[model samples]
Target chain A: MRQILSQFGTDCDSGAAPRTMENWYEHREMIEINIVVCIKQVPGTTEIKIDPQTNTLIREGIESIINPFDTYAVEEAVRIKERIAQQSKEGFSGPESKVIAITMGPPQAENILREAISVGVDIGVLLSDRALAGADTLATSFTLAKAIRKLEREFGKISLILCGRQTLDGDTGQVGPELAQQLNLPCLGYVIEVMEIDNKYFKLKRLMEDRYEVFRVPLPAVISVSKGINEPRVPSLRGAMRAKSAPITVWRVSDLDVKSEEVGLSGSATQVIKVFSPHIERQSEIFTGDVDTQVEKLTQKLQSLGVV
Target chain B: MDYFLSDEQKMIVDIARKIAQEKIVPVRKELDEKEEFPHEIIKEIARADLFALFVPEEYGGLGGRIFDVCLAVEELSKGCLGVATSYAASGLGFLPIIISGSEEQKKKYLSDLASGKKLAAFGLTEPDAGSDASAIRTSAVLDGDEYVLNGTKQWISNGGEADIYTIFAMTDKTKGARGASTFIVEKGTPGFSFGKKEEKLGIRASVTRELIFENCRIPRENLISREGMGFIIAMRTLDKARPAVGAQAVGVAQAALDESIKFAKTRHQFGVSISSFQSIQHMLADMATQIEAARALVYAAAKMIDSGAKEISAASSMAKLFASDVAMKVTIDAVQIFGGYGYMREYPVEKMMRDAKITQIYEGTNQIQRNIIASHLLKSA
Candidate 1:
């Protein structure tokens, strides 16, 4: 589904549809959303090729993609905005909603920012600069919180933040919660189902280790989505064409009102000294015989291993 | 993914996903439990202007290509088969009027049905005659300015909820299939009463009931074509509706495959996710392969129809058979992957499996489809 994001406070029925950006603060339905999507652009899995010599992933010739899980996060934010806008039109113009997708990556990461626009996001911000590179979870959150503050200055106050539970490449589920902490937003992790969201609060059903928990979090909260929260809609052709030229706002550390020392490697609390693939042992014993013989052999092996 | 939907096709999928998730998804369980028709969802679909897709633009319809319709049906069925089938049967009921109805008839019925102001149903199957639709027991006797219809039609989708019904009955009893004729039966006619609704294994939200025509009379203009062309019209209609049923089945199977793949990757069973095991991986690969194959055939059949191609009995039957069978297999495997949890009502996959089983039985059962394929192959030889 296409997501729609507009600012709160404008009278939509009073010919304000065309001039959405200027008077967004007037439409109440466009108001309380602080949709901060922590998105990252990585190599497309299908486009990635393996280097035969070093057993490493070849980055060249591979097209970059917005992390698969993060797309759902952006979509959920857009959906919330659309719901609010639609509801506002039906006389419940309480507090409005806005979707702002924020990413911390290289300059080229702006492509995914535009992609998010095609999915119905209103604003895109790229946190880029030499000082923002090589940041760990702590520094990433610190940089993101600064960007959020700047977004608040431009679009008024924000109420909700959303992000993917983990990026595919990093596989670290820490960034979303850490970013929530930096912004002082109440955080809900592994949210599989979003039951309802009104102006003041939103209810969510989060998947836990053994059972699911339903919680109602106040505004200015953070939620990270797991896969299967909802099926992500494909981008429309018109949306994709429009996204091709969508302007993406870029921000450096100086623009975000952050101390230079509070970013990059300096602000990071944890650092990986070395990176290597884990060793996997494989000792194959072929059972080339009748099915009964193979079964018997398998049973004997299981018994010997104390698995039976 | 590339095998099924193109970049353009994905747009339709996106719209369908939005509609399914926002409009249809919320009411699915309640509609099923209450056995209530999704009147609101239908209005929303019409508001989106999707119902008129098959109708030509000259008739104030969207005139969308068949592939687009399939994409829409597939996505909608993923949310709930009953609702999707109810929406899809509009095309089945209206196609006859579109292909053969006069401009006046099109203006009178198609416009309202397409605009979502009224519902329509197709009445071809009787309790005694389902696979053998030629053996219709309903008889329509023409007397000067009117034809009186008297018989019962079973398993009519949309049944009493429809404002208009395209009915098939025997005009001349001696002529077998050729003697059959089609008529448009408007609701509120005297002697027209609905029978008890059928409680089925799946597609529960859609109303399927028998229509009893006791001396029901309509103007001679209500006849869709000449007195002896109902069988041909119905056969042609099935050629189109069969592919749509295939699309619905593929949607159900796709939902199963997606859920299974996600569960396999996360649910651990022996110190690791089951997806990491070769046995589970092989199951997923097989399910994916079948889905791709079925999708290809369904789209191919749909494209052929959109191109205004001649009769393609073999292609339609093959697509329906492959898709329905794949739905059965994929859903079974999905249930197995979820272990005991899959059989529970809380999970969506179990319901999808139940929904998938009916596609094999309806729109010309897979058995009948196989017969059509075999006959076509032998005749060519």
Candidate 2:
């Protein structure tokens, strides 16, 4: 660190004025929003089988599609961008908005990227490599966080990172919050509506089990959206044509500066010993009596079971 | 059942079917009951580039023809014949531009229609001009740079909704059919207005209204082809479009058949499923067979039109005639198969039957279609 500072000092000493870290770069308020949306491709159907030995999903025959929930995220992102444009037209625009969707998968996964672009995404990036094969949620988040940092550097500061609350195949929704944690940013999950947004803060409606909760969180945060955010629009003819020929940026493990052990199954924090489907073990009791008698017996049974 | 559709054709079916099933089916009942237009679904169709199936690739379309349009119409009709009618009406509106418009007109209007930015409606039918199209009273008189249009178009589908209109009117009434000329009119012209939405027994999801053009003046440039070509343009456009109506009939009949088969399997009587009965089985078989035959004929006719086959008017009339009659019969049988439940509004067969009635009546009544088919037969070898 001393040697590097001295070299910098010697360069400044060559007839340059004294400079401090604070004064080295000019500071300006940001009005443009560069967003990163994390999306994934999952099987079109849920009738996927799990390999007993690997305890992993067997995806050879099934067709792929954008995770249904992620379409809501894509829709919300486009809505946000449109809202920004609408604000500008009304002279109330706070931040310029652009959306970039990224997915980590095999080469064929690029189709989902094009699908995203067809729905109004500005561009797409694929983090594809053999090293990203069997990543559990944690490793997946770690890898995604790394790519986001790289994107933030390449395309200015990112205002927000959007994601689906949960993927269809992996019902575990740890990736969104985990990515926020890995990047040390605020995480807002289960967002159903974005009531207000600007460069500074965003007012969001988050869905709970019984009710919806509202939060006013600052921008530059990671947000996961539920399906209720908005209905996804169909791809416009022009948008689809544009997406067909649109160029997508591809990044490998080396490009993202991620080590092999930190991404794939080797770096996963948990291991699955077995994979199986759960079935309900239902038992029924039949009452033999007239309707009134059956009702009385049912009430007595409920009272005995303490369910009343 | 097998049309041996190419991969692209099959893909068109799959995409349209997916949209119809996922988007249209859910709200079809409500749309019918409320008589509401499906603005959002049409936008979805636009987004999916289905509207581009009608125009050529040079005009910002998918470069497909009537066959492709039929494929999509059949799938969409499965969801709701009314919605399908709205889309088909828009195609009918702009098809004149494709068939007869000059390069400048095509350049100016076709792209917008092709891209789904604007919707279109045809304005040829009048209260007095049902089968005798040459008798239309709508008049367009030239005045310097414009032609003043005076008349009304009755039962115009997408009447109040579409932004563009292709209207037929008499330029020189003394010349009879030769006096007719086609004109492209915008929806919000100074003297153009619409009447109240008409109530219908079926296809209630679609709107039917009257277009009143009282001293409506349009640019002379809007005249399609020439002053005396209106009837020819209208005829040519209908020749290209009749097979699509046949496709719609096929789709609606297929939907009825689909509901009947599903109902039959679960409905039980005499301690066995009704599907097990020979009479019910025969009805189901006949309905399926009729739909398949209708589909085949519609596809064959659409192919002939697309291929530029000469004297295709007869084939077009045959497809529309046969398929519509088949649709009416199949839907009735579907109701019959459903027994008492079929008469109830809870089931969809009754609505299918109502929708089937219009396919036989519109474009050209089945009687007119028969006349056309016989005329061509008498002239051929």
Best by TM-score: 2
Chain A TM-score values for every predicted structure, listed in order = 0.80, 0.81
TM for chain B in all models? 0.96, 0.99
Q: What is the TM-score of chain B in candidate 2?
A: 0.99
For every model shown, what is its TM-score relative to the native structure? 0.59, 0.87
Judge the docking of candidate 2 as incorrect, acceptable, medium or high: acceptable
> lDDT per prediction?
0.82, 0.89
Question: Alpha-carbon error at A127 in model 1, in Å?
Answer: 22
Off by over 4 Å in 2: A1-34, A43-64, A81-99, A105-111, A114-133, A150-158, A195-205, A208-219, A236-255, A272-283, A296-308, B2-7
True contacts kept of each: 0.04, 0.38
Error of 1 at B352 (Å): 0.8
Please write out the lDDT profile of model 2 over residues A212-277, one tens digit for every residue: 999998878999998888988766555766787999999999998788889888879987787766
Tens-digit lDDT track of model 2 for B127-163: 9997899999999999999999999899999999999
